[model samples]
Target chain A: MKAFQSVAVIGLGSMGLGMARSLMRGGHEVRGCDLARDALEKLAAAGGSAFNTPAAAAHDADVVVVVVVNAAQTRAVLFGPDGAAEAMKPGSVIISSATMSPVEAQEFAARAGEHGVLYLDAPISGGSARADAGELTVMASGSPEAFSAAQPALDAMAQTVYSLGEDVGVGSSFKIVNQLLAGVHIAAACEAITFAKRLGLDISKVFEVISKSAGNSWMFENRIPHVLEGDYAPHSAVAIFTKDLGIVSELGRKQSFPLPVASAALQLFLMTEAAGMGQDDDSSVARLLAQIAGLELPGMERSN
Target chain B: MKAFQSVAVIGLGSMGLGMARSLMRGGHEVRGCDLARDALEKLAAAGGSAFNTPAAAAHDADVVVVVVVNAAQTRAVLFGPDGAAEAMKPGSVIISSATMSPVEAQEFAARAGEHGVLYLDAPISGGSARADAGELTVMASGSPEAFSAAQPALDAMAQTVYSLGEDVGVGSSFKIVNQLLAGVHIAAACEAITFAKRLGLDISKVFEVISKSAGNSWMFENRIPHVLEGDYAPHSAVAIFTKDLGIVSELGRKQSFPLPVASAALQLFLMTEAAGMGQDDDSSVARLLAQIAGLELPGMERSN
Candidate 1:
């Protein structure tokens, strides 16, 4: 494989830090950038270069993986003031891994094309732990050239890379579609867990039964354990869904399509954010439901 | 294995037929009854007894499996005009597998207790295919005597039986809770598949990606193939969720709970029914979304 030895990963939060480490593990020369000094310093301590600005990291990088928070930050990292797009070589590729709208991804790809740089609409999943293990799932779409150029870094990072298609927005569209299901499943999991708790069934037993039954989801099996343990650590925060579901609702609105399930789930996520649990783990959504139901879960008191 | 020498399955729908055959295969003398003469005759030809009414089948049966549509039918079969509750022997066990509200299930159990007959609040899942293979999952709750009485039928019909508790309503409550999640997941699956199709991506490819990603759902993997094949054969019909989600919404309303996801899913199923696809497979809810989004699915000529 034609490997991209110099890789830049923007936004050195939990997910970005893991991707940077994975790239280094894959024998790539990696530069990580973030706004937080401590996060950058930690990356530097882990045998990688750390930069305060995106341009500093993107310079001479063959592949850039943008893992920022949203469309605004992703745009800022790529084409904002002293943006990385202007500094990258003509043949270099940008693998955008943020959960953004299809329109924004399409715009980013178009502008990147103007600079003669390939753009892959790649949105990362499997959370921070998978990112750290270089085992994230990448829902990706781009030209054959872009896939070829990004293959080394992609191989270094993702265990499952879905080649959505050649259309720029299609990959982001799939990601948005995916977020709709993921976000809804998490809230549904919250409702089911709290409902079982309220019904006086054993919460852990309910989890075990439902996980084996048809009621299970990837989110339920993953998130309900956090609720059961009463751990609110931010593996993936409630704020992330606040952003992802907002993108889903916005895209549905733009298309004049009514997404009641996604809309209801967005409202629940909004309530979670409104209740001041935005930074808590997304499983904190169960806490919101428990608070509403006036019930207590195992290993935890009532949310109120 | 108390050995159900003579068993009567009171409904011969998709679930009941498979269950009766499984019981017959388990060396039970199976008697199947249904209002439909054709269904009863079909079972009779398969080397089991068939009756036009419940009275003829329940007179001397040791075990009775009631797999009717919902709570009302279960009530009608047990207590309505010409009901079989009066005809069954004092010690015979009645296994009620209808998806009902906890309050209703409790009332039925109490009423069955008055008849000196054992009642098991047993709700089965895993569709007809599993039922045919005797590999269905049963969510059961009842007294020890009721469990002991129902064991022959349960063992013959289910590969996994979750003994929720020894209370009558607990099994039904768990099933309702399961329905809440199952209904929401099926609706979410339809929404995701429709959203992906509208974005001009291949439906099969999206299914492939989402199944491997965090977005994967039990319902999505189980039901999307019906949509891809353009086969609306009623594995589970739209009207099934129309009733199940309706029951869920009713429970939420009565309990004053905010079940937005379940309620929204109920509304969508109602819409799917109103579109005259009530008897079609529940996966055809994807066509409802496709109609709204103005996208054509494979094997369907028009977007609508």
Candidate 2:
């Protein structure tokens, strides 16, 4: 692989910014654009070129990585005001890393193809920590040409890149499936911790036992500390699950399948969001449950 | 703890038989009873006395460890014809190892007190293998005397013994809390695997990606292999969750707290059971979901 290639990272949010730095660390000449002035300034401070529009950042780049929020935002970055797709050189690859439905991924692939640009459906996992370390897991699929084109950037951004055949949309399907379990597990962790508190258990003891026991999940071990410490900071916000599980609910209904566990979890996130904690960490549902149950959870004695 | 004490094991099923042998390995004089003559003979072969009834088994025992099925069976062995509680000497302890409601445990503790016996509300976790190795985790509570009397037996049967307090019901409450998470995780794992199948991805690949991803759970890592290999053998049966989650539902309603995720998991177990897999491994819910979606799961081409 070439030690250096021009790469455009179209968003510099938590995940995208870490990925931008990771790309630079991997010796890629990185340029990025974001609506947030601070984010663009941060990328510039990290010695990468920063721009206000996707077109300007992606201009003359070998690869354009769209790390925006959903299908619509990804679409916007590729085709909207001063979008990257029309400006990206022919044969250049567009690596889309949004958590969108397979159908949306397929649509974007076709549109990118029409612009004579190769499109790789690449959905990433691992939160900001992994993203910063260049250790995210990438679920990706596209033409072999696209794979070859995206190889250097993919190597820079991911610890694991699954080449899921030459079909588009498959990577998104895998991502949505992952989001389904991730969402449900998060809600279950919230439910379990609050339920433990209601039982008059030392909630911290519950965490220790469950961490070693069969009840444990990545979410349970990773997210329950927020509840124990009474911290509601958005390590990952409750609104993220609302969006992801909404994608799952939408996709499941499209297939005529029921997602009882995930849907129940969605209700919890939705309920928490409605209760005004959508911006808080997803573990805030535990607080919501505790508040409703008239139980005082740790770190919650002072709060309403 | 004493190296030698007369102990009666009231059940000799998978978990019970292992506990009995573990106690014997700890140098206890173990006497046990079970309806299975093979179990009784196995104990005899191990040089422990195996009687036909609880009373005969409990005769002159210093500790009577009741490892029966539920609250009712525990009551049957302790109070019904040829009951162990009456047969046990006064001041001896009874360690109850059934998954029952806290209220039932409290009631049993009260009744055992009437028989001049100290009752320990001790519910065991970790499966038969752990039991056989004397490495089970015991969530236990009772009086100070009950803990002191049960210590030798507990040391024999468990690697980790949690003295939840002097209250008889707290141990059961902790166990129930553990069950709530365990059941929901199992169901979510099943849902994820089936959803992956519907997405037309390699199901084993889903396992590989998810094992390292945030979607992972103890149940997912432990149970998804059964689905991949298409083996439905009961490592832990589906009926167990139906029963355990039933207890959770019962207790949650009693506390007036909604258990939506656990309740969803209970419905999946119930649906799988109704489809005739109650005795199969809890992961059998994955097969049920595949069957509904008309997808062929591994090792399932031969079955209806």
Question: For each candidate, what's the DockQ?
Answer: 0.78, 0.77
**Model 2 misplacement above 4 A:** A301-304, B302-304
Interface RMSD of 2: 1.0
Error of 1 at B272 (Å): 0.7
lDDT scores of the candidates, listed in order: 0.88, 0.91
lDDT of 1 by residue, A219-255 (tens): 9999999998999989889999999999999888887
Docking class of 1: medium
Q: What's the distance in Å from true for residue A210, model 2?
A: 1.0
Off by over 4 Å in 1: A1-4, A302-304
Which one is best on DockQ? 1
lDDT of 2 by residue, A180-248 (tens): 988998898888888877777878878887788888899899999888888998988989889999999
